[model samples]
Target: MKHVYGTTALLVATVALTGCGDSDAGPMPGMNHSSSSTPTSAAAAYNDADVRFATQMIPHHQQAVQMASMAGYQATTPEVKKLATAIKAAQDPEIKLMSGWLTGWGKPVPTPSHGGHGGHEEMPGMMTEEEMSDLGKQQGSMFDRMWIQLMIKHHQGAVAMAKTEQANGKDPASIALAQKVQAAQTAEIATMQRLVGQLPVS
Candidate 1:
């Protein structure tokens, strides 16, 4: 019985020691590091595709902001103004966000095809010199109807650009921005459709 108990005790000790590695063998020192590789996050692995997407989107969003401001300043309908305000608010921050990404990525900040970022000076879809005069020349239903029609087209262009980015962009941040644009513009499209229904028919 005494011999059997000693054998059993030895076996238990052996099993316990084998279950865990030696305590004295601490993790390797100095230059040695985790054998496990660090995973790159979506924000960390940006490439050229992401750069171009952000660049193109900056100008595209700027154009939308321009159109929205027109509705804000000129449209008589409260609904039109509200929609315009939403668009302007949405696009303005996006412009800054894209600009920051370009800066962070060491890419060129996007410039519009027309020129520098000046106030509503001549942003695309912003009424032209003659167009502005024409908008001013009209009032009430004419202005409201024209504003909604023009903004709907402007938002449509944004949707097109966002779709392109979704399919082609590589960076996580860039893709995220593109997805956001798609979702927001899609919703805005529906709003514009509803507003169009309210406009005075020419």
Candidate 2:
């Protein structure tokens, strides 16, 4: 009977030690397994596609913010002003976020296209100086109509870039951001189309 109790006690002790083993003695909860190939940081995981997406998007978003900023003073319709406000509010922060990601990856944040930054290919939906100058000169209903049209074209370009990122980018965060950009811009495009329909002829 004593031997039987000793065996039971030993089994119980073993189970208790296993259950109470130091939680931090092995790999941490979120840690990658110890391997020579593990990335040292999330930024180290970014590839060329991720770098390109961030660089392209920074300038693209800057232009959108510039356009939206004009609506505060130039847009006629209450809806146009409201939509512009929402757009600027949403995109300004995203510009910062993408810039942050680029900086973390030791990549150069592209200059805003308005700065005449050279070498980079023209991003889709960027307004030429002539087009932007024309838009800037309009007022009242004319301004509202032109703004909606240009913004829709701008958003379509963004959606295209985002789709490319989704398909080709290897970084998880960049891919997730690309998915978000595509979904949001597609919805905004629909909104702009509806606004266009409501505008009076020319």
Candidate 3:
């Protein structure tokens, strides 16, 4: 019975850690007033792809929020933490943005993000489970190296998802958000690549 309780507690902790974003972190960038002043009325409401993108992306953004948040605690350099800070700041507001878009359009907000990494396999640049585990266990230079690598990969995945929405989504708000994601993640990818090159690990 004690063992069962311990296992349950461990599972809860793990779930809370990975499944919830922003435990010890600040809000993502541009997280101000959720109601965009005079929401841009789109030609049509959300589509299936819009729903898929928002539903899938809430957790994906949350994961970036989670990893970016961890950097402040574990990273050694300002650049690493700066990039992490940027990611955390940017994603938080976007999560609310996407959620609001859904609510305004009478679509459902994303289901609460679940366990396991996001479900989009075609999306670019995600790290494997082994890599995430290795990243979590590392410290100092090792932590810095792993964080850069994983975050680069994470940003890449986000960009891909945004691209999918850009190509297929109909809603004005979702498409605008997707475009913003493309610009942001693309810039971050370049920055992350440069940072990783400077790291001793690779």
Candidate 4:
């Protein structure tokens, strides 16, 4: 009876140890499963083209925002001021959205050049430093005309970039954003053209 009791005690101890081991092991797999799947799923959804689109478009939109900001104080025409407000409102969020994409993709987010163009002047529809400076100096109807013209050119550049992304981008979200940019900027360009005709020559 003594030997039998000792054997039963040993068996119970072994089962308890095994149960403890399983309980400790259980959470590790779940932790790893969650951590690994999230990044993989996000990374898999984008490709290099999507990264490029996000990277380039961030600064591009920043410049547009800068241009729009100038209208707040300098523009005399109500229509130009309204359009500028709209441009800033639309592009500011887009800049943030693309920046978020770059962060998620493990890509570097482009910093805004502030008053400068971040050396992207060669890009479609980007204004040179001189042009932007000149626009800044103007007020009244001259500012209105110049702002409309430059904004039209800027929108054209954005549309061109969006088109490139639409053609080559792999991520559905990026492509959808590209389509949105294309449609919105194209419409803005038409509106600017009409405004330019109505405004007197600066």
Candidate 5:
């Protein structure tokens, strides 16, 4: 009958349109959206904690690198020099890593305030300019002792910050990096403390 044919046609068209609508609606239900246009990963969900961790830690690591660089000429002890080299190697790459994260997250990387090169004071565990200047003036055994003491404090500060990141960060990458920081710095703190006891009182 004409009526039956018309109803069948209408049902077919309705089914076709429904199929098209579903196809256009994006990935199928339960599909991993990360593979498609929507990035539903932890890295994409950078929160305030992640941003703060990156911004604050960059300057902290920069100061560590600066202190480590000073050891090449200022440090007299082989152990101190070795530690400094390791610190530089570890922290310089981390700085770059955090910088990349900030850039990818569309957040501004925190630069040194007042155009101060190596703006260490803006963050905790950062050396004051005067303290750095004093350390710079030292050499031989004196440099070795002061460097160990200062570095211990610096590492402690980094550990504290990293712990905060672990507690508060949403981004998986940032939290992972913070865990690394906490472990590495805490170990370094133990090493520096041992070095402090071994060094002759200055």
Candidate 6:
């Protein structure tokens, strides 16, 4: 009976020691028990350039999304439709992503201007009210041709903006996104240039 008690006490002591050791170790580095409930600090670090990149890119992408949506009904060519779908797919998420960054960084998200160019007429690749109206008026093969031309120019502006962000933006996430934008838009620009030639002028 004494041996049994001694063995039981030893087992309990071992468990207690183990538990104490675990307690002393505390939470592992970078590990959070309530991580799901906690907001991540990954976006905590940012700068003026990062803020500007996110702010500017939001509206730029919004316009691109607008243009892409128009291709649904306006463009007659399958390739143009496909390209427009892809552009919308790519830019829409990016707009949300950049908007999130701006919000997290405590920066004000740029509201899209209604009717007019929203004072973004001077912004690279931004279409004026007249240009957007003109594009909207076109249909069938004419829209395909004009959209390809205009989108190519629009993509060029986005690429330029991405390059600037990559060069000047401080946040790693912003810079990485800018690099992705540059490569993707550059490829799309090439595709549009080729597509425009095949589209009928009328």
Which stretches of model 1 miss by more than 4 angstroms? 1-44, 111-138
Spell out the clash pairs found in candidate 4: none
Model 3 CA lDDT for position 59: 70
> Candidate 6, TM-score vs. the true structure?
0.78
Per-residue CA lDDT of model 4 for 19-53, tens digit only, reads 99999989766654543333221455577878877
lDDT of 3 at 175: 75
Clashing pairs in 6: none
TM-score: the better of candidates 1 and 2:
2
lDDT, residue 195, model 2: 92
Estimate, for each residue in 60-176, the C-alpha lDDT of model 6 and write its tens digit: 888899999999888899999999999999988887777776676677888675325565764588887788999999978988888888888888988988888888877667777
lDDT by candidate, in order shown: 0.67, 0.80, 0.75, 0.81, 0.81, 0.79
C-alpha root-mean-square deviation, each candidate: 9.8, 6.2, 21.2, 7.7, 5.4, 6.4
Question: Residue 25 in model 5: shift from native, Å?
Answer: 14
By TM-score: ranked, best first: 2, 6, 5, 4, 3, 1
Error of 3 at 22 (Å): 46
On a 0 to 1 TM-score scale, where does candidate 5 land against the true structure?
A: 0.76
**TM-score on alpha carbons, each prediction:** 0.66, 0.78, 0.72, 0.76, 0.76, 0.78
Worst 10 residues of 4 by lDDT: 33-42
Q: Which candidate, 1 or 5, has the higher lDDT?
A: 5
Candidate 3 per-residue C-alpha lDDT over 1-202 given as tens digits, one digit per residue, 9 for 90 to 100: 9999999999999889875665444332222223233232241456888877877788788777878878989999889999899888998988887766667667666543453654646445655567767888898988998888778778878888899999998766677788999998999999988988888762
| Model 1 C-alpha lDDT per residue in residues 1-202, reported as the tens digit of each score | 9999999999999988876555434433211222111112234457777776666667767766766777777778898889889888988887887777777666778666543444333223343456545765667878888776766666666677667777876765566767887788779878878987977775
| Candidate 6 residue runs with Cα over 4 Å from true position | 1-41, 113-115
For candidate 2, list the clashing residue pairs, or say none: none
